[model samples]
Target: AGTVNPLLLFDEIDKLAYDVHGDPAAAMLEVLDSAQNNSFTDHFLELPYDLSQCLLMTTANDADRIPGPLRDRMELIEVPSYLFDEKMEIARRHLLPRQMEKNGLKRTNLRVDDRCLMRLIEGYTREAGVRQLERVLGSVCRKAACEVVEGRQRVQLSLARITEWLGPVKYRQEPAAAEERIGAVTGLAWTPVGGETLEIEVSAMPGKGHLQLTGQLGDVMQESARAALTYVRAHAAALGVEPDCFDKIDVHIHVPEGAVPKDGPSAGIAMMTALASALSGVPVRAGLAMTGEITLRGHVLPIGGLREKLLAAVRAGITTVLLPGKNRDSLHDVPQQVLDALRITFVNEARDVLEHALAQSPVQDGGAVLPDGEAGHAAVCH
Candidate 1:
């Protein structure tokens, strides 16, 4: 089969094995490099093959895991995860018909309405792509086919029947807090699969000033915790925290799901808020989630994965989100319905984040006074 120009897809290239056996990334680089691939040859056959004319495409779950040298040779284009509505349409338009044909069922043999499909998507599957959703659909088709063979002329899947066909719901999203909490804050995190809401909790106990971090955090996140604490200590007076209060207490910070490793600089502001709340007894408002990096001087810096993070916030039932002002422009990538669901506040500094995120000023009985014009939304920064 001598195809002039064939299309080749390399799936999950980032999962290439690394060991003494061979250098997979280096080999991929040679194949992907148009300049070097023209005279490429299969080692088994001593024949030169011109692969330069073939269009090649590669995909990966995590772009950062790709080798630097190999990544430099390819144009990187990020594909965002599908939303619920998109998945529903895709299943109705493509996956369901394909599975129906494969299961030897006529279009009229089984009827699964939109309600049942949505239930399957939300309850039975959780993923960045529709692959799992498609599999679930295929399973539904097979079940219907079995019924048809067992003397049933037609089958209709209702919302109630979906649960019976599939086992119990496999995934459940974390619910947002109903009321304000002390020393607890909601943070947004970006993972290789998708985004998730991270809850950070802090506790202060009487001791000789020691900071403890938990929840299987990685090195960068641990450093972020230190930066947040330093910011809190540096601005103790302004935050209504006694300047020497930290010296007499031991503080511990923890993220939930201790078994899962967590790392990133995006939680800097959330860590700082938790510490300030614990020290000042101020409660952060419920249904408020935030993500952005912070500096020692209390400036809010931009973070990546804005689209995924915002979607996760909405899924968690958060009503408001605090994002770095610099990321304001990145909101265009997010779906408008998601943007409209929440009140998004952009901040350039840590104080603005606190102003928007906290239920009230941290000042206890006016111990520390805030200047005017700092009480409301931060000005939109370019």
Candidate 2:
């Protein structure tokens, strides 16, 4: 059996232990190497074996925790979290039927409609996978079975019924309502579970020329805020912001939900919009959300998780999204319903982001407007 080719599975390989006993991951390297495993030897058997034909597969919750050399030896395939619609389909087609049989309930006796399932998903469960959803469905089926045993012939589940059974809603669909105001902008963020709308708020006060960043932001996000401020400062004259504004006042940028640590470059455009709005006293357009990185030269850089972000934007009732021009190619991955629900603008430069994000021109204060001919010049500089 040792010599026979067998499939091997290593679960939670990232948690493989290392100690004085020796490293399992280090030992696995030899066994996993196709070119070397043909004559692999086991210490216990004291015999040479052929394991070259053996298939190896591994799973991990976080790939970054895997040892670098071990990770480099295998092909990496990232499985993104399931979307809302996907979860609804899975529940109707698979989970409901399976739970009905397991709970000794007839399919005809217990019926769950799409609306009920959607309610369960939105209010009862918040997860990237369907394990919790399956459990919830099973709970519903068990309750239905009990009712049937008590002489209730049939049970139909709806949102109201789901709420009664589930006790209370576990999660809020949207964290906060979208408000139109100066110095506050909505941003799209991606998490391990799903996408969420993040609000970046900027406020200016009388103090030394310093930028204060809060909300447990990581270094990368802090740098993004600095870059955003610099861009706004460099184009202050064009944006109709007073040149000495930053020199005389301190700016504070904060992302809500301070308990959760956030680090990424995708909030660059949002930060820029917030800062510009705060300085120019112009409100950002209501229900507009955006995500992208920005360069010092005011070019918008592409970021990942576009699909999840867009879905989040739609869920938050955002009517418009501003994304990098380079990300236009990835729009095909987004559902057509989401595309149709939101007006998406692809922008190449920071000016374009401002043009769409701000409700009115920042240059409304009688500032010198760039000539039509200079539009091409600004684009060239970008």
Candidate 3:
């Protein structure tokens, strides 16, 4: 251990603790520092130890929980959650064989179709990782093992058999194929579990220019709604809305699934699109999804979790995705099959979002209008 370099892995570094006694994170800072670790001394050893040659690797679900100085010392590589197809491949190639062996079931005795595996993924498990999926497969294998012992020679698992083995479905997917309407737009969200679809709904009614927000939104999301409304008001003339529309109307922005608390700046463009659609009396295009932060000046800003968000969009039957121009570089992370199945457009401004999301052209003074091509341009498609 003297001169030979050793690799050390610290798993779940976010769970590191601190108390009145001492801060472990602070101690880790010194160990991780290349400049100081060369002569680092252990309290118990009372002797200097050279840690400069040591390679340190850490894993954490949320990097934000790690101390800023310690986090700054390491290069962050984000590993996104697996997509549906990737999960299926992993299950088929790895989990099914492993679980079958553990349950004492011969490979020839049981068969699970690909469609059935997909059903299990969509209905029984809702997580970012495959741990839940492995457990569910283990459960199915255990049941099949029992059936074999009870004199059933061959067992075939299908979608219908999932409920019999795993009880009622635990998760319900809101129909993505439902009809599209005005004042509602789909936004992609990234959570600790994975990417999810967020539906933002906006409605205007007669009032004294009040903006009401609901659905347990956090501060940043509320601010996003405000920025979106402000942008719309500033561009009312261009959008073909009455200049004083808000003076006699109240605007309400609501995200569905109200029980789950929602926050983040990434929903800005979605909220803006919803407001624009509602105010302009145009319906949002069906099967279209988007995610991006928006500035008061209507410029779109990049957000995180592009790959995960695009996967969520695809799962929800979305055929087109609008992304910020800055995020175009990350398109390589998405699978080529997914990219081929969808129309991905990159935009630098809110006007670009409007052009793709609106079902009909914006109306001004009772006549249809087009966005100024000179104002901004679209990024090349992926």
Candidate 4:
């Protein structure tokens, strides 16, 4: 009791139980609050000592787990997780080289190249901090030491070798669906770890133009799609489409890999484009990728991960990429090789995107020159 004791330490206070029976933690508020503590009445122990004399401290692993009402009473401090570069720095400057010498193995006896380190971070470990990364590298060092003790003079591990030793890559891009259809767009999303390419698919059936969604999309994303559809319908006349196209078709939008939930309005533009292409008998320019949210006004708002998305598009063999005009500042960060190989189009409107994302008929061999908009459906945007 705060009235009887002078100090209190609450470990795992975040996990305290709460219900009609009683929340002991909530009952302890008066004793814990310094301002009102001196006037607190303790029914448990009939002592009248000042509760403010007690020093109270609480600890928790994840702050989110703490009840909001309780969390508000405490001062919160956050410790951010580390990145790969920070892990590499820690390993190179301290971890690996230290472990090698401690295990009595010379630097010449074993070496892990930068690529190998990257593999260890990307494939063997999934962590925001290097605690696990340090442990895995320790295991690798132990194995390398055993090899040196025998007859092996030197060893170097590559990305593939890391997988062989670690049993399999912990992370790999989910394979895009084998069948690339007219209404699907592969979008890259940036997370705290890195970029993940998300496959957004839109399918339509002969019914009223109702929007149906699946794949655990969040409210923001669902709203983004709604806004996107509204924008497309409003601009139907200008895009050379019928106003009743959506009214006549029942459309379903899905982001594959339902196990992982996704949110954010950034994918709105991409979703709109895919659905527009599907309903209008047009194909999204093969290899052309886009991101951004659209409103009823048809403005393409910028999204994050410009460089990472462009890189993902390039890896997917996409040559012509469409990006929000506001993200032009990020263009400088893209590799020259990607820039040279791909045609990058930046636009502020959905119409600008539509103009470039459609397949233009390619000039047939030894035939008449094709017109600007006559490009036949070639999925190869590159």
Candidate 5:
């Protein structure tokens, strides 16, 4: 069949069957690849057309799932998960007003405090997108509307009321509890929903020094962990680890919050740091954040999202951060106030990060729990 002037959008292209069984993705690839585009419409391996004139937009829940051949043909734009602050602003400017109108309540009658919005974003919802947040707010607005219809003169959304209305808190800020271990590093990650903290826990046990990975990690993160271990072993002296740390120790790396799978190259620095911290018996600095890729020679390679990741640190109440020195240029976009307050150290080598990033100071005896319904976690979206 001959095609029209169609702008094709391959939605959820990643989930399309790509293996064996006739390889639908492989068939679809010819349509996408510029060199082979003419063949898509050709009947007997004939005819050529200007396929470049056609525009294509592809959407996927996870880009990593796309076939490499198909992915290579496209220019990728990443829309990171909304930080709590951004989400609150989104809720305030867009969600709350619309929801209030929908619920037959004026914005004045129902006030969702900025703090309350943050609480909703942090504790109630956990997605890369605001789909759940919107739904939850919609429910709240509907309930408030019902109350107004039943003769309650006013409507209000309070943090305490949120839990009563929404039920038990869905997500906890401290997903991973502190344990007596040196090898675990809390890694901050940007997801489609928002900034999430991941704990990369490493431990040594008796075995032939095997590496075990869990928590449904992806290939890149797994590879990054391997690279981190390699760098740590190679630069043991610089990292303050005995050369044989990996030789005799069977290492197991796990990401806490097992139900929520995590994968990325950005966790490389954290993995390396966790290994170094674990092997050297040094704890990662409390309230310090870091993100970057690592090389085999102990070099700290730059990673993306300097602003999002840094702001993630800030929101976590982190006072210091160790990022790749090469990424220093990206700091110009960061706010000066945040820069001034934070000990943002740039390190070219992964080893140097430990000197400043890992804690020499004692960890605080206990963590402060946010009272019943407070928007805790130092909410910020800069």
Candidate 6:
């Protein structure tokens, strides 16, 4: 620990509790800042220390929880959650064997087939890393050891027995709806744990053109919703919505799982699709999920967490996805299996996405369509 230039890791520094006595994070600025760190003074040492040669690293489940000034000083490298196959391979090659040895059992004493391993990954564990997965494997090893002590020579773990060991599937991924419905669209979202699917629902009622957004959306997401409504209103004539439709009725947009917080620009296209479908009485196409931001001028913009979002869509049995054209090159970062499973369409504007996302083409009802490859709004992700 006293070695020069030792690699120092600050584990979950973001989880530091607020103390009335002092600001630890504020003090960190001096330690991390290279310009000042050469003359750094630690209260513990009460002497000048040079941290300039030391390599420092930190981990956080949610980077947003880290203070802005402190976050700015460090380089952030996002470690994405593993795919199902990756988890399975890791279990077979590393976790399972190590767990067995730790529990005084041999590989031949406990055997788990791919089916059981797959169930363990998809059902028992939910995480961005394999810490929970290792614990689950360790539990299975201990249980197998007990059986061995009972005079059983070998233990063959079956999928049915997995329910007994791990209980029921804890975090099941729900697939998209069976059929298309008006004002309903499936959106992919990135979570603190991993990726998830959100069903955005919209309803129109007779009132004074009011827009209500629900589902614990954050400030940026709420702004995206308002922009979606504005886009729908501005393009009503082109998209076949009555120009006065907004003036005649109040519209409410809600993302299900109301208890969970949902945010980000990734829901922009989905919100616009739901709004367009509600106003035009058209249904969103089934088996399709989308994520991207949209502008009031009807342009599609890139979003963040593309790989995670696409993986979510694939898990949810989505067959098609609409992404911003700017994110097209980012597809290389996604797993090839996920890309092969989905039909991805890249769009530069709203009309292109609506044509692919809606059950029926928006231009069919005596409406015009926006030209392809137009300039769009802000982009921050992917």
How would you encode candidate 6's per-residue C-alpha lDDT over 1-382 as one tens digit per residue? 7776988788998987778989888778887888888888889889997888999898999999998988999999988789888888888899999999999998789999998888888888888779899999998888889999999989999987788887888888887788988789999898888888998999888778788989999999999999999988887767556576577788899988899888888899999988877776667888999999988888889888888889889888999999999998888889989999999989888888788877766454434343321111001000
lDDT of 2: 0.82
lDDT tens digits, residues 1-382, model 1? 3795898899988888899988878778878999989988766797888889899999999988888888888899999998778888999999999999999999999998888887888788878888988899999999999999998979999877777888878878888999999889999999876788999999888778899999999999999999999998898777656667777778899999999999999999999888877776667898999999999998999999998898889888999999999998898899999899889999888888777767676443423333321321121000
> Can you give the lDDT of residue 254 in candidate 6?
94
Candidate 4 — which residues are off by over 4 angstroms?
Answer: 1-95, 99-104, 125-135, 146-161, 174-181, 304-321, 327-344, 360-382
Q: Poorest 10 consecutive residues of model 2 by lDDT?
A: 373-382
The residue pairs that clash in candidate 5, if any, are 81-192, 127-193, 128-192, 128-193, 129-193, 285-358, 285-359
How do the residues 1-382 of candidate 4 rate in per-residue lDDT, one tens digit apiece?
4256556788866677878888777656765677778877767786665767667778765576777767777787644445346678987888888778877888898879888887777667765557677778877887888888888999886666666666777666444444435778876665544455777888777676678999999999999988877876776544445565566667789998898889888898788877766655566655566777787877888887566566566545666667789988977766676688778788787766666665532323321122321122121110
Span of 10 residues, lowest total lDDT, candidate 4: 373-382
Q: How far is candidate 3 from the true structure (C-alpha RMSD, Å)?
A: 6.0
Write down the TM-score of every candidate: 0.90, 0.84, 0.87, 0.63, 0.73, 0.89
Per-model C-alpha RMSD: 5.6, 5.7, 6.0, 8.4, 9.7, 6.1
lDDT of each: 0.85, 0.82, 0.85, 0.69, 0.71, 0.83
Ranking by TM-score: 1, 6, 3, 2, 5, 4
Residue 50 accuracy (lDDT) in model 2: 85
* Model 4, global lDDT: 0.69
lDDT over C-alpha atoms for residue 338 of model 6: 95
Q: Looking at candidate 4, what is the lDDT of residue 360?
A: 34
Residue pairs with clashing backbones, model 4 = 360-375, 361-374, 361-375, 361-376
The pairs that clash in candidate 3 are none
Error of 4 at 24 (Å): 15
